[model samples]
Target: MPAVTVSDITTLARIPEPAPSAAERGVRSVTEAPTGFEGEGFPVRRAFAGVSHTDLDPFIHLDQMGEVEYAPGEPKGTAWHPHRGFETVTYIIDGTFEHADSHGGGGTITDGDTQWMTAGGGILHIERPPEALVASGGLFHGLQLWVNLPRALKLAPPRYQDLRAAESALLSTPDGGVLLRVIAGEVAGHAGPGATHTPMAMVHATISPGAQLRLPWRRDFNALVYVLSGAGSVGAERRPVRTGQLAVFGPGDVVTVAGAEHQDARHPALDVVVLGGAPIREPIAWGGPFVMNTRAEVLAAFEDFQAGRFGQIPAERVPHGDLGELPTQPA
Candidate 1:
């Protein structure tokens, strides 16, 4: 395999048709993400889920949360909740978030940090804005992805990986116009620190004026790109995509994205996240916060949580550090 570099990504720049046997292809479909509320009335847009858009295999759910601004003391987040049989990847883009779980895991992740949590057997956790941030009132934006565990690892031990932004792999064009921050997997020989039971890649990219990128991906993995901000063109055909839209790809190992010039100067750059992974191709029994291979396992997860098997969080230990005046809800 050839090394993926800044120059390698621009092979199809300004081109119309991909060459015969080209590793990249055009877009298959462009769809809008569904908007909803979860985690104690926190607003989010669903990129995909097993209940709908079932083609994405190991990745069960993707949620793009509030890029929306909030008044002082109005931000909302989830209280303690139990999860089992899968993992949750939380990527913070613009704000601070505090985390606490039953496994004695806790941390404060600010801008550009990713928290990968695996709720293998069962784990109770809380995720929300810091109290201080709520008091100040500002923009809070990020992504939360639910990656399914294979049946073999469904009952594995719970764990957490905190990947800070400074530690992520940064990819840029030769002239420094385009920037890609890889949080997991590899690009141009630079790999993220996230350890995974299931192989996958997650990249956050920012495209400046007229910048372009061609990303090499695993041929066997299913891939999709979500437009987080501004407008841009994706794939070889340069299909136009806007914020809140998801571009699903066809069979190919590479995808191209270009930054388009926009009339609004306030939002000149394009922001996107690329994600891909191999299909688990196993039975999925999903309930509120649990994902298992069978309904019986899901039931057992609930019973374990109820029986105090997942552990407990002390009231004094709960994160009130930056909680501000916003009312907190129990999960």
Candidate 2:
């Protein structure tokens, strides 16, 4: 993938997103992913449940992190951890997240920034709120998704990509009541900034009252939508979903998402993320932080971590950088 630079951002972002094609439409399924907490005390609502959902193959898990507002001087975050055989994609919406890994890769991703980390082979990393944020309380919200790697690439080298909000490709409805931001894959011929080993699309969209949007999709991909806030309807069946709900779509080449005609002013727009990927149909053995094709591979991952091959950061050295202190939102 080509690196995104300042000179080209405006032009790329201005490109119009593909409109939804008029074709046979069907509402495959609408189900809410269970919500719970993981990692220290942070709350997370899982969009995909269990080891795997056939409809959401290749994309193993999606965790909607706390949209919680922390009390002054009482912030909390994740501790050092190890992962292998897949990739971790973190997208922040409201707060700051400081990251550090064994490969000496570290950075801060605040509002609208995304951090995509491939934990191939193995890696020890930590993600937490910065000390400055903890000292002064604020809102913390984001989403962390786990994308399964094909068996052939599960043991590939680890890599990281941090994309700021401005680097993404953005498009809006003619009247600007709806906005679509593509972070990965292409929309309406406009390519996003993040490159993926697996073919996928990660789009964040916001629709205002009575607005409608139709985006073209790939027939081969298993698509799903998660309403981050407010309420909306989607597909030909016009399945309704509100905040914290996950809608898994059936096979289709075009997705239709529309906002409520009478939207609540407090939560005026329907905010959601559309995710889809080509399925990796191979058998998978999921064991906590590691995901592999075979039980033996899963054992090997744990052994390697125990043997210290994943590398480690001192527990005392928290927040690794002052990245959170930088502007929370991109210019």
Residue runs of model 2 more than 4 Å from their true location after superposition: 1-25, 50-52, 314-331
Clashes of each: 5, 2
Q: Which residue pairs come into collision in candidate 1? A: 130-322, 131-322, 131-323, 131-324, 132-322
lDDT of each residue in 127-243, candidate 2, tens digit only? 888889989988888899999999999988999998898888877655566677889998767778999999998988887778877777888887788888888798877888888
- TM-score versus the correct structure, for each prediction: 0.87, 0.88
Worst 10 residues of 1 by lDDT: 322-331
Give the range where candidate 2 is weakest over 10 consecutive residues by summed lDDT: 322-331
Q: Write the per-residue lDDT of candidate 1 for residues 131-250, one digit (tens) a residue.
A: 898798887889999999999999899999888778877666555667777889876567877888899888888887577777777788777889888888999899999888888888
